[model samples]
Target chain A: MEAWVRKLVTGCLLTLPVAASAVAASEQAVRVAVIGNSPPMSYVDESGKLTGFNVEMAHALCATMKIRCNLLPTSLDKVVDAVSAGEMDFAVVSLLATPERRKKVLFSKPYYRSLSIWLSKPSIKPGSPRTTVAVVNGSVQAQHAENQGWKTKRVTNHREISTSLVAGDADATVVPMLTAVSLMEKPSLQALGLESTVLSDPLISGDVCISIHPGRPELREQIDAALDEIKRDGRFDRINSQFLPFRLL
Target chain B: MFTTSRTPDNYRHKLGAGVLLCRLTAVFSIVFASAAAWLAVDQHALLENMEDLQSRTLPNSMEHQRLARNLEVLRLEGERVLAADNPENRRQALFIVTLMAGHPSLLANEKARNLAIETEIFLTRAAQGSRIDENIRDEWTRISRHLSLTADDISVDGINLAREDVRQMNGLVEQTRQKLHGAVALVLGFLALLLLLIRRMILRPLQQIDHALSDLRQPGSAVTLPNYSLRELASVREAIVQLHGLMQEHESTRDDLQKLAATDVLTSLNNRRHFMFLAESELTRAQRYGRPISIGLADLDHFKHINDIHGHAAGDLALKAFADIIRSTLRHSDIAGRYGGEEFAFVFPETTPQEAVALAERLRAHLDAWVIPLKNGGHIRLTTSIGIADASAQALEDALRLADEALYQAKASGRNRTIQAKTTQLPLPLGGHTDNSGHSA
Candidate 1:
C-alpha cells in the first residue's frame, strides 16, 4: 500500500507541467509582426528592445483575448507579405492601406490619419513648380508625389528624407507631420527652417488601420471588439494622449 | 448711377466665381488640417507606445512568460527526477532542475524562488542516491504547487500589462475617429454657410444684372440696378450703372446731331427746309384741332440794291441784323426761319389773319429800325417789307403761296410797309390797307 501511494504521488508530480503543455497546445498562440524601425508605432528603443504603439497594442489585445502573443520584428515592406503567407498572424506598424495591400490582407477600422507635410530649406520657395520632393521609399507620400507629377527622391524613411533635404540631395521632402514637428524641435533641423507650414494638404489621408491576414476575418473582428471596449472605457484616450502630441480617432 | 474709376481698389475688392470655391476649400482645409494635426500628435503618441511596448511592457511580459515556461520545465524535470529508474537519467533531470533554479529570470518572489531552490536540492540529493520517503514526496508536491502558483501570478501580471497597452492604443484610435468626425461636421457647416452667402450676394446680383441687360435690349428701356452690399457685387452694379449712363449719353448725343442737321449754320436758326416742315406740321395740327393758324413773310426793302452798293459783306451784316430782330420780336410760340436769301417766314398757331398782320408789322418795324455795322467802320440802315397770310380754309402749301404773294404785294405797294394777301373767297381788309404798287427803296 505504501508503494502504491508512492507510485500515485510520482505519477501526479510528473504529469503537472506536461498536462499544462497539453492544454496550451490545444490553443493556438497569436503571432504578431512588430517593426523595429518605425517609431511611435512600433520600433526598437535605445535599450535595443522591441516596443511601440503597435507592439504594445498587440500584446494588450492578446492579453484581452486571453491568448499568448509571439512577437517577431519584421521589415515594413515584408509585414503584409508575412501576414498574408501566414508566417505572422498580424502586423503593427506605420502602415497605410492601399488597393494592392488590401488584396493580400484585411485591414481594421482606421485609427488615425496620415498627416503628411512638406519640409524644405527656408531658401527654397514653397510649392516650387516641378521641384523634386523627397519621400520615404515604399511610402504613400512617394506615390502621392509621383501621382501629382512632382519629381520624387525616394529614401529609406522619414529620417532619411530629412537627411536628404539637409544634404541638398533633394529639394524638399514629405514626412508625417509629427516627424516634422520633432525635426523642428531639433536645433540643427530648426536652423534649416522649412518656410511653409503648408501641409500635404491635398494628400492628407484617412485614419490608419491595423492589418490582418486575409483569411482571419474573425481575428479582425476580435481586435475591433477589443478596440470598442477600450474606447468606451476611456483607456484608448489615455494611451493616445500619453503617446501622441495630438488627439486622433 | 454709381460710377467708380478703374483703380486697384476695384480689382482688389472684386469678388468672382472663385470666392465661393475658395471658401469651401478653406473650410475643408481647416477640417483636414485639424485632423492632420491630431494625427500627427497621435503618431507621436503611437511612437511613445512603441517605446513603452518595446522597452517596458513587451519586455516585461516576455520575461514573465519566459519565467513561467522555465517554471514549467522545472516542474516537468522534477517529475522526471521522481520517475527516473536509472542513475544517469536522475543526474540528467537534476542538472536541468539546477539550471532552471539558477536562471536569472526566475520569479523574484522569495517563496517561489525558495521553492525552486528547495526542489533543486531535493533532486540533487536524489541523484546522489539519498533515501526517499513519503514526507519528502509530499514536500516535493507542495513546493511544485507553490512554484507554479508564483509563476502564474507573474505571467498574469505581464499579460495584464500587455492588455492594458492594447486597450490604450485602441482608445487612442477611437478618440482620433471622434475628433475627425467632429472636424468633418464643422467643415461641412462652414461650407454650407459659404455656399448660401455666395448664392445670395454673388450669384443673385449677377442674375439681376443679366436680367437688367436683357431689358436694356428693348426700346426705350430704363435701367434699374439692384443694391448690393458686397464690395464685388456692388462694383458690378456700379459698372452696370455707368454703362447705362453711357448709353443714355450716346442717345442724347445722337439727338443733338439730328437737331444740328436741321439748323441753319450761319443764322443759328431753323433753316428753310425745317421752317417749311414746321409750317406744314402746324397747319396739320390747326386743321385737326380746328384752330386758326397764319403764315407770314418779311423782306429787307431793296436788299439786292444794298448788296450792289455796300458790297455783299454789308448785305450779310444786314441779313444777320434782320434775323436777330425777327428772333427778338417773335414769341416763343411763334416759329420763324430764314426762308431763302433775304426772305423770312413765320407760322403762328391759333392766330387770326388780323393777328398775323400785327405780328408782321412788329417784325417789319424792328427790321426798319435796325442798323448794320460793317467791318470797314461804316454803318448802314436797313428796312423790310412784310407779308401776311392766314391758314383759314387753306392747306399749308396754299398758305405758303399766299404769304409769298402777299410779300410781293407789299413790295409792289411800297418798301418798308406791311400788306395782307386776299383769300380766294374773301375780300381783303380795307382799313389801313393799300392796293398801290410798292416802290423799291
Candidate 2:
C-alpha cells in the first residue's frame, strides 16, 4: 500500500506540469523572434534581458490572445532567417518583406514603415560623389548608398555610423531620421562639438511586416486573425499607444 | 560603234534625294532625335523617382514608426525619472530622456521636439538637484503625456505622407508608360514613312533607270528612258536625255568634219591626199589578186593661158566644168581625183593600159566638144591632154612616172589627145614642143 501511494505521488507530480503544459499548448503556443540590438523596436537592456517596443507588444498580443509567447532574442537578420527556417514560430522584429525575402518566408500584413533621411556634417553637401557616407552594415541604407555609387564607410550599427560621421571618417551618413535623433544626444558628440543636420527630401524607404516560416499556415492564420481582432478591439491601439506616438497597423 | 569623251557633271549635293526631300529628311531626323532624347531623359527621371521611393520615402515611413517608439520610450523614461526613489536610477532615466529628446525625427516636428526639449530640461534639472518633489513630478507627467500625444500625431502624419508618396509614384509610373508608348508609336510611324519615301521617291526611280539602262545596252535597242517624279531623279533623267542629244549632235558634226577632211570642197570629189590613198589600196589589191590595173594623168589644154585671157573667174568656171565632165565619164568602180591645181589622176581597177587609153581618149573628146557659157554670155571651148599606163603589182610608182611622161609628150605633140606609155622603162616621145604645163594652146 505504501509503495502504491509513493508511485501515485510521483505519477501525480509528473502529470501536474505535463497537464499544465498540455493545457497551455492546447490554448495556443508561439515562439516570437525579437531583435536584441535594435533600439526603439527590441533591444537587450542593462539587465541583459530582451525589452523594447516589439518585445512588449509581443507580450501584450499574447495576453490578449490568451496564449503562451516564447520570445527569442537574436540579431535582426538572424531573427528573420530563424523564423523562416522554423527555428522560431514567427518574428516580431521589424523585418521587410522584399520580393527576395518573400521567396524564403511568408509575411504578415505590414505593421510599420520607415523614411530615409540624409545626415551630414554641417559643411558637407548631401549626395556629393566626393563626400563619403557612413551606412549601417546590412541595412537598406547601405544598399541605397552603394547603388547611388556614393563612397561608403560601413559600420555595425546606426550609432556607430553616426559616430563615424562625427569623427570625420565620413563626410555624411544616411540613416533613419529617428535613429539619427537618438545619436545626436550622445555625450561624446556634445563634447566634441560635433553636430549633424537632417537633409530634406528622403532618398529611399521601406516597410516592415511580421514574418513566418512557410509551412506554418495555421499559425499564420491565427496571427492574422489575432492581429485583426486586436485592431478591431482597440487592444492594438492600446499597445501602440504604449510605444508609438500613434497607432501602427 | 558609238563614241564619246564626255564626263559626268560635278554635283555638290551628296544625298540621292533632291534638295526638297533632303530638307524634309533633315527636319524629320531632328524631330526623331529630339523625341528619342526626351524619352531617354524622362526614363531617367522615372528611375530617379523609383530610387527615391525605395531609398528615402519608404524608409522614412518605416523609421517614423521607430520615431514613435523612441518618443514613447522617452515619455516612459520621464515617468521612470519621476518614480525613481534613488538618485542613480533617476540619473539613468534622465540620460535616456535627453537622448530621445534630440532624436532627428522628433526634431523634424516642431511641437513634439519642443515638448521633448522641455521634458529633457526638466529631467536634467531634477537629476542635478537629486530631488523630484510631488509638484515637479506632476509637471513632468503633464509634459510627458503632451509629448506622447504630439509624437503620435507626428507618426500618423508621417504615415499619411508615405502613402501619398506611393500614390504619386504610381501616377508618375503610369504617365511615363503612356509617354513611352506614344514615343514608340511616333518613332515607328516615322520609320515607316522613311521606308515608303525610299521606295516611292528614291528606289522606284532608281529601278526605272536601271531597267532603261539595261534596255539601252541590248543590240538595236530603241527603248525610251523612263521619266522620274522626284526632283533629283527627274534632273538625272533630263541630264541623260541632254547627253544623248549632245552625243548625236557630236556624231553628225564628226561626220561632216571627216567628209571635209577627205574631200575637195569645191568639186565634191576626192582630194589629192584621198586619191593617193585609194590608188595605194588598189595597188595592194592588184598585187594580192594578180589583177591588171590602169592609171592615167590628164590636163586641161592651155589652162593658164585661158586664165590669163578670160580672167580668174572664167578660169575657175572652166576648171569646175572640167571636173564635172570627169565625174560623169568615170566608171562607178573607177577612182578619179584632182591631183593638183590643173592636173587629175584616175585608177581603173581590173582595166588594162589599152582600156585606160580608150577611156582617156573618150574623156579628151568630151572635153574638146564641151562649151562653158560664162556670166558675160560668151562660150569658151576647152580641151584636155591624157596619158595612160598599165600598173602591175609593186610597180605603181614607176607606172605613174611613165604615165606623167607620156602626158607631157601628148601636150607637146598637141593638146586634146590621148597617149599610152608602152612600158615603164620607155624614154619620153621627142616630136613635140617643150611645154612645162601639162596643157596645150
Candidate 3:
C-alpha cells in the first residue's frame, strides 16, 4: 500500500501543474480600450462602426503584438478623462503632448507634429514690442510665450483670441500654422486688417500620441514594441496616406 | 256706476285709432334713422383697422431684410481671410473677430472676452517668424476647442432665448388682430339685430295701423289691428285708438263744414276750390324742379238727363261710383277732385303731354266698361268724355283753358272719348330718351 501511494502522489503533482497552465493561457488575452474621435484618426460612422487613422494604426499595432483591441468612440475632451480613469487602456486623440497633461497620463512618442504662428492686427507693425500676444489658458503655447518674455494674456477660446486681435484688445496672438494659413485666405480677415507671422521657435507644436494609465510599465512596453514593429513595416506610411493634405508628423 | 253714453264711447274709439296711427309713424321714422347712423360708424372703424395693419407690417419686414444683408457681408469677409498667405492675413482674421465682438448682443457674454485673448496669441505667433512653432500650434488647438464649445452653447441656449422672444412678438400681433376683428364683428352684429327688432316692432306695426285707419275711413269696416308687444309700440297703439274716437265724433261736423268748403260731402272727395289749390301747388313744384306738369278733366255724357230719368238718388249713386272709379285710377302723387255737378279734375305733376294723353284715354275706357249696380236690381252702363293738357313752365290759366277747350272738343266730336291739347315751347327733358328704367347707365 505504501509503494502504490508514492506513485499516485507523483501523477497528481504533474496533472495539477497542467491544469494551472491552461487557466493562465486563457487569462493572457489582454483587453484594451483606445479612445478617439478625429476623422481618419478615430471616428464612429452612421453604422456605429469605428474607423479612421488612429483606429487602423491601433489595429495594426495590436495584430503585431497578438493582443485583443477595442475602440471607445468619444469626444476629444473625454479621451483624456477615459485614459486617466483607467476606463480605457489608452487614447489616440490628436492631443499636444504638453507638460500639464504629462503630469496626469503617460504619452507615447509623437506620431504627428504642427507649428505655431503669430496672428496680429494689420494696423500693428509686425515687430512691435507693444503688440499684445494672446494664448489659450493651460496650453503649451502660453508657456512658450511666457518663456519668451512676450506680453501674453489668457483667452478662453481660439475664436475670441482672433476677435481680440481684430478689436485692438491684443495686437497679436498665437495659433496653429495651418489655421493661420487658412484664415489668411478669407476675405473677411483682410477687411479686418488681420495678418500672421509663422514663429521660428514655434509658439507650440502639436504631437498626437496614445495616452496610457500612469505607471503601467508592462503594458507600456508591450504597446511600444507593437508601435516599433508598425513603424518598421511601413504601416505608418499606409495609414498616413489615408489622411493626406493634413500631414501627420 | 257703469252708466256709459253711446255717443261718447263712439267718439273715444275714433280718437284712439287716429292718435295711435300718428305715434306709430313717428316712432318708425326715428328708429330707421338711428340704425342708419350706427351702420355708418361701424363701416368707418373697419376701414381704419385695415389701414393700421398694412402700415405696421411693411416697416417691420424692411428692417428684418436690412439686418440679414449685413450678416451676409460679414460672413463673406471671414471667408477671404482664410484663403490669403501673409502675416497680414492673420490681422484680417483678427479684424473680423473684433467686428463680431463689437456687436452688443455678442459682447455681453464672458465667452466673447475669452475668445478675444485666444485671437491675440494667434496674431503674436504669426508676427514672430515665417514658420509656426510647436507651442503656438497647441495653443491654437485649445482656442479651437473653446470656440467650438462656445458656439455650441450659443446655438443651444442663446438661439432658444431668441426663439422665445420671437414667439411672444407673434402672439401679440395675433392677439391685436383678433381683438380688432372681434370689436368690428360685435358692433356690426348689434346694428343688424337692432334693425331687425325695429322693423318688426315699429315699422311693420305702423304699416298695419295705417291700413286699419284706411279701413275705418270706409263706410263699414270691422278690421282691428293686433296690439304691439313693446311699451313704445303700445303707446302708439293707444294714440291711434284715441285718434279713431276723435274721427267718429267729428264726422258729422266735418260733413257740414265740407258742404260750405270745396269738398263733396257724400263721396268725401275734394271739391273745386281744393282741386284748384292742389293743381297750383303742383305746377309751382314742377316749375321749381324743371319737371313737366299736366291736367285732365272728365264730365258725364248726360248728367242732367240721368238726374231726370233715374231720379236724384240714382244720380247720387252714379256720381259716387264714378268718383270711386276716378280715385282708383289716379296715382298717389296725382290729385283727383270734383270740379262741379258731374265733372272731375286731376293734376299729374312730372308727367309729359304724351303721358297725360295716355292716362286720360285709359280713364275714358274704364268709365265705358263700368257696370253700376242700381237699387232696383239692375246695372247701368256709364260713359265719360275726358280732356288732357300739359305744360313745362307756363301760366296755369293757359293750361286750364287749353284743357277746357280739349273737353269741349271731346263733347263736340261725340261724347265718351278723350282729346289732348299740347302747349308750345316746352323744355326738353335731360338725358335723351334712352329707355334706362331697367338698365343701368
Candidate 4:
C-alpha cells in the first residue's frame, strides 16, 4: 500500500510538468488597450479601422515587443479617464504630459513636441491687452493662459475655438502649433493673424506622450524598452517624416 | 331728349396708361441695379482668390530653391574632404567633415561618423605618396564612392521633398486659376443673364408700355396692349385697366358737378341767382322780339307750422313734396325753384300776367292737394300763396314783394290756404300796411 501511494505521487508530479509547460507555452495572451483618436495620433477611419501616426507607432511597438495591442478609440478626455481607471493599459492620444496629468497617470518620455501659438484676429496683434485668448475646455492650455495672467474663454472643441477667432468673437486663441499652422493656410484665416511668439515655457510646452496606468510597473518597463528600441532603429524618424508634413514640424 | 358722347372715358383711359408706364419703368431700373451689384461682388471674389494663390506659392518656391542651393554646396564640401592630404590637413578635414555631418540631410549619426572616418583614412593614405599610389588611389576611389552615395542620398531626399512642395504649390496655383476662371465666367454669365432678363422681363415691357402711354396721351388712343409675360407686370396692366375705369367715373362726376352748379340741390330746381340771370336774358330777348314775358313769385302759407309740427326731416319732406307739385304744374318753358327757404320765384317766357296768375293758382292747388308721408306715421299738408307780375322794365322788384305779402295774408286769413296778388297797385305792403292796432282785412 505504501508503494502504491508513492507511485501515485510520482505520476502526479510527472503530469504536473506537462500541464505547466502547456500553460507556459500558451503565455496567457495579454489584452492591452491603447487609447487612440486624434489625427496623427490615434483615430478610427470610416471603415471602423484604427489608424493614425500614434496608433501605427503603438502597433509597431507592440509587434516589436511581442505584445497584443487592442486600440481603444476614444476622445482625449475619455482617454485620460480610462487610463486613470486602469480600464486601459495606456493611451496613445496626443495628450500633453503636464504635471497635472502626470499625477493621475505615468507618462512615458515625450515622443513629440508642439509649440503653443497665439491666434489672433487679422485686425488685432498678439500680446495686446484687447486680445482675448480662447482654448478648448479641460485643456492645459487654459491653465497655462491663466498662469500667464491672460484671460481665456473655454470652448467645447478645437473647431469652436477656431471659429470663435474667425468670427471675431474672440480677438485671439491659443492652439497647438500644427493646428495653428493648418488653420493659417486656410483662406478664411486671412481674417486671423498667427503670433510669431512661441510659448516654450515648461508650463506651456506641449509634449505629446504615451500615458500608462499608475503602478503598472511591468508594463511600463516593457513600453519604455520598446520605445527605446524604436528610437534606436530609426523607426521614430521614419514615423515622424510620414507625419511631419501634416504638422508644423 | 338726351345725347351720349365718348370723349370723357377715352381721355381718362389715356391718362391711366401714362401713369402705369412710369411705374413699370421704375421697377425695371430697381431689378437691373440689383443684378449689377451681384456681378460686382462675384468679380471681386475672383480677383481676391487669384491674389491669395500668388501670395501663398511664390515665397514657397523661392525658399525651396534656396534650400536646394544650400544642399548642393554641402555636397561639394563633402567631396573636397575626400581629396585633402597630410595628417594636419586630415585633422582639418575632420573638422570640416564634422560640420558637413551635422547637416540635417545627413540621415543618421552612425552613418555620418562612418563616412567621416573612411574619408579621413583615405586622406591619410593619399598623403604618404609624392605620386599617386595604387593602394591610396583605391582608398580614394572607395572614399569617392562613399561620397557619391552620400550625395545621392542627400540630393534624393532634398529633391523629393522639394518636388513634393513644388507639386503642392503648383496644384494650389492651378486650383486658384481654375477657380478664378470659373468665377469670371460665372460673373460674365450672370451679367449676360441679367441683361437678358432686364430686356425680356423689364426693358421690353417698359418700351411697350412707353409706346402705349405715348399713344394714350394722344387723343382717341386705343386701350388694347400686348400681354405682359410676368405676373407682376400683368398685375400692373390690370391696374391700368382699373385706373381707366376710375378715371371715367371721375370725369363723369366732374360733368355732374357742372350740371349741379346750375340746379338747386334741395328741390332739383334752378337757383335764385341763376334764375334771375336767365330771366334777364329772356326779358332782353322778349324786348327784342316784342314777345310777352311773365314772372311769378310763390310763397308757402304758414310754412313754419310744418317745421314746428314735425321735425326737420318731415319739414324737408313737405318742402320737397310742395316743390314737386309746383314743378308738375308748370309748363316745360316755365322755370321754378326755391327762391329762398319757403319762397319760390318763377319766370315764364311769352306769357301774360293773367296767364302767370292762372299757372300760380294751379301750383297752389296742386301743393294744397299733395300730402307727404312722414317717418312718424303722419302726413303733411301744404299750401302756397302766389303773386303774378308782368316782366316789364320797372315792375320786377314789386312782384317779389307782393308774393311775400300775399303769403302773409293767406296765413292771416286762415291756415292751409292760397291767395294771389295782381301785377298792379303795388300789391299789399310788406306787413299788410301795418296799422297801429294790428288790424287785418
Off by over 4 Å in 1: A1-249, B1-156, B167-260, B375-378, B392-394, B424-441
* Per-residue alpha-carbon lDDT of candidate 3 for residues B1-441, written as tens digits (9 for 90 to 100): 122233443344333444555764576556555555555455455555444433433222322332232233233333333334664654555444434433323334465445644554454444455665677556656655555555555444534544554555566556556655665676567567667866887789889878877777875355476767655555555666666666665775787776669677866688888888878888988988999888888888777777777888888998998888878887778888888888888888888877877777777777777889889887676777777787566767778787777777666666676777645533222111222222110
Interface RMSD to the true structure, each candidate: 23.5, 9.9, 20.0, 18.9
True contacts kept of each: 0.00, 0.00, 0.18, 0.00
User: Which has the better DockQ: candidate 1, or candidate 2?
Assistant: 2
DockQ for all models, in order? 0.01, 0.02, 0.07, 0.01
lDDT of 2 at B312: 92
**Candidate 3's error at B291, in angstroms?**
99
Predicted candidate 1 versus true structure: per-residue lDDT over B75-190, tens digit per residue: 88898888877554554455457545654445354655777788888777765566667876887788778778877987897799889998898887787778777767876787
Q: Write model 2 residue lDDT over A1-249, tens digit each, in one string.
A: 999999999999999999998987855667888766656566677888777677876887677667788887766546656877888888886665667678888888776555555656555666766888888765667777887889999876655665686678887777664454445445554444333333333334456678888898776777766665555455655656654443343
Worst 10 residues of 4 chain A by lDDT: A240-249
Residues B242-312, candidate 2, lDDT per residue (tens digit)?
65555566766898998898888777778999888899899889978999898999888788888898899
**Interface C-alpha RMSD, model 2:** 9.9
Question: Chain A TM-score for model 1, please?
Answer: 0.80
The CAPRI classification for model 4 reads as incorrect
Residue B418 deviation, candidate 4, in Å? 99
Candidate-wise lDDT, in order = 0.72, 0.71, 0.63, 0.61
Candidate 2 vs. true structure, TM-score? 0.40
